[model samples]
Target: MLLLLDTANLEDIKKGIDLYPIEGVTTNPSIIARENTNFLSRICDIKDTIGSGRMLHVQTVGLKADDIVREGVYLNQLMGDNFYVKIPVIPEGIKAMKVLKSMGVATTATAIFTPQQVVMAARAGASYAAPYINRIDNIIGDGVKVVEDISRIISTHNLDIKVLGASFKNTEQIHKACLAGAHTITAPLDLVETLVNHPLTGASVEKFSIEWESVYGKKLTYDF
Candidate 1:
């Protein structure tokens, strides 16, 4: 699975990139709202920190098809081909997706919950259909299943749409999405850190450190 960091602040974004094999960066209105950085400047900062060939997803809240297309074009004009314009799966978004897809700009149709939403996004020609796994699990109790069904549907239809499974709460959620064959996952830094620092794993490492201090200055080494 391709792991993405959904962060806005420069420090957090840089830190997330450092900790994981970050394939991309996912940003939304809420994430951007947390910081007062200029939109284009922060995007530049994100790109600079993450280096080249990594995606940067930007969301647009357009009320009409024309407006959505305009904003999507505007956003694309600012970034490289790897950047994906994130549009909602709403009516106007679907309309906008058609235009952008025809223009060859990558589009990520986000805020997806149900399988029907995935179908619509796939038909709309979105490159990525992002489903909020944690948010759906809160309502339906089996959010992972939605991703599985969507994957199957995409395969059956021979659609090029990717399941960018998002809103993960823990490593378990990520595991489920992977098993379901999601194309990518946009996870928060907190969850990513949790995955890296498993409780039992951390405890064992700590215990090893204490024991090592009695013998040598260091006792850990990885050989390949």
Candidate 2:
């Protein structure tokens, strides 16, 4: 599954990229608002840092269909082809998705809370549909099931859209999302870091190091 950091903090972004096989970065209005900087310049900085090959998802703040379309177009123009314009699954967003998809621009339908939303967004031509996993679980306790159902529906209908699960609270949620068939996930740095921070894993590594040192006279592998 593809993993993307759902943050706008440059340090977290850099560390995540350097420490993991990060596929890309994703940001919404809330994430961008936290930076409190020039919006365009900040996004441009992210573009340069992540470089051209990775996907950078930027959300549209507009609430109207026309305005959303214009914003999506502008983002594509500003960030290039690798940028996936993120739009909500509201009615206006569906309209904008159709227009943007017609123009061959990548679109990610966000703020999804139900299977119906996923179906509609996929039908509207979203390249990826992002379901808020933790948010839905908080509301109805079936977020992972929703993702699984969406995956089944997409596969049954042969849709090309991918499920990008978001809003995770912990590594367990991410694990469940992937097991439920999400092709990708976007999460904050803390939750992502949990993917590699198991206590048993650390203990096992330390034990292996001690055993190796005992047998090899504490010498490094390069020691002659």
Candidate 3:
């Protein structure tokens, strides 16, 4: 599964990229606004930090098909071919996806809450479909099951799109999403850090360190 950081903080992005095998970074308008910087400059900085080879998913703020297409084109021109324009799975977004597809621009359907939305977006030529995991669960729906159903439907119908699960509250949700067949997941930095952190692992390392210190009189490996 592809792991992505869902944040616009430069420090977090740098730290995440340095600490993990991050495939890319995903950002929405809210995330961009939180940084309180010029949109173009901030996005440019993020693209530079991640480099051109990694995927960068940016969302469009337009609500109409023509506006969405225009925004998608503008972002594509700004970010290059590795960019995936994130559009909502509404009617206008589906229409915009079709237009963007014809223009050879990649699209990711966002704000998805149902399997049918993914199917429609895929049919509209979106390369990826993002489902809000915790949001679904907040509404009393099974988020992981939705992802599993979406994956099953895609495989059964042979769709060419991937399920990119988003809006996670904890590492367990991410874990369940991946096991449910989500091809990718984007999460905040804290949740990402917790993924590999376990008390037992820390305890084991400490135990080993104590054993070594007891034998070596607190000497470094290089000193020995």
TM-score of 3: 0.97
Model 3: CA > 4 A from native: 222-224
Candidate 1 versus the native: TM-score?
A: 0.90
- lDDT (tens digit, per residue) of candidate 3 on 1-224: 99999999999999999999899999999999999999889888999999997899999899999999998899899898589999999899999999999999999999999999999999999999999999999999999999999999999999989999999999889999999999999998889999999999999999999999899878686745
TM-score of each: 0.90, 0.95, 0.97
- Tell me the whole-model lDDT of each prediction, alpha carbons only: 0.86, 0.92, 0.95
C-alpha RMSD between model 3 and the true structure:
1.3
Clash number by candidate, in order: 0, 0, 0
Residue 113 error for model 2, in Å? 0.7
For residues 38-95, write the lDDT of model 1, one tens digit per residue.
8778777887777767888889867688998998898888777688989998898898
Error of 2 at 131 (Å): 0.4
Q: Considering only N, C-alpha and C atoms within 3 Å, which residue pairs clash in candidate 3? A: none
Model 1 misplaced stretches (Cα beyond 4 Å): 210-213, 217-224
- Overall local distance difference test of candidate 1: 0.86
Deviation from native of the Cα of residue 115 in model 3, angstroms:
0.3
Least accurate stretch of 10 residues (summed lDDT) in model 2?
215-224
Q: Which scores higher on TM-score, 1 or 2?
A: 2
Q: What is the C-alpha RMSD of each candidate to the true structure, in Å?
A: 2.8, 1.4, 1.3
Q: How many Å off is the CA of 184 in candidate 2?
A: 0.3
